[model samples]
Target: MPKTYYGKYGIEVRTNEHNHKGQKAHVHVYIHGVEVGAFFLDGQLMVGNVKRKDRIAIEQLILSNRDEFQAMWDEFQKSAY
Candidate 1:
């Protein structure tokens, strides 16, 4: 899974990577080693095992990492849109 620069909250920055199949191109976020949730490059909710606060934080993280996430998708999919 390719990782990406998500966001920074104080000293904490949300980061994620691509995982699984049967799903669209997206990233899974984690703090330390625990799985929080997932979100699509189109900015949709896809969190697997996260809380509401984490979901909110993930949204903010998405805005900041949107480009990186998109870049990852473009590179991974290798398709033009």
Candidate 2:
């Protein structure tokens, strides 16, 4: 998994590329080591629980780092082969 940490939040791109059926580009979000949910590159939560404020913050963070995160996700997909 490729991961990036920001303060108390950890965002990761999981390596299970074959499991992404109908799913868009996303990252799994962890807060304080607990899995919160998976979020699309656009900052929409796919599944799991996240407080509104935290979700907003995460959205901003994702938007700010969208390019880098997207690149990591793309690389992970390629590595599935």
Candidate 3:
């Protein structure tokens, strides 16, 4: 997994090249090292729960770093073959 950390929050893009087939590009969120959930690049929560305020913050972070995240995802996908 490729991870980026922001203060107490962490974002990770898990490699799906050998498994998780059909899973969309997304990031797993963590707070204080605890997994919170997974979210799409658009900031939508794919699964799990988060406080409203935290969700908004997460959205902002994701949106601001969208390009970087997408690039990471693309690289990971390219290795699928």
Using lDDT as the measure, the top candidate is 3
Over all chains combined, what TM-score does candidate 2 have? 0.87
- Tens-place lDDT per residue, model 3, 1-81, is 778999989999877654375667788899999999989999999999999999999999998998998888878776744
How high is the lDDT of residue 2 in model 2? 60
Regions of model 3 farther than 4 Å from truth:
17-19
TM-score per candidate = 0.60, 0.87, 0.89
Answer with 2 or 3, whichever has the higher lDDT: 3
Preferred candidate (TM-score higher): 2 or 3: 3
Residue pairs in candidate 1 whose N, alpha carbon or C atoms collide under 3 angstroms = 38-47
From the highest TM-score down, the ranking of the candidates is: 3, 2, 1
Report the C-alpha lDDT of model 2 over 1-81, residue by residue, as the tens digit: 667899999998776554464457888899988889989999898899999999999999899999988887767766644
Q: Give the Å error, residue 50, model 1.
A: 1.3
Judge candidate 3 at residue 50 and give its lDDT: 99
Candidate with the larger lDDT of 1 and 3? 3
RMSD of 3: 1.7
Task: State, as a TM-score between 0 and 1, how close model 1 is to the true structure.
Answer: 0.60
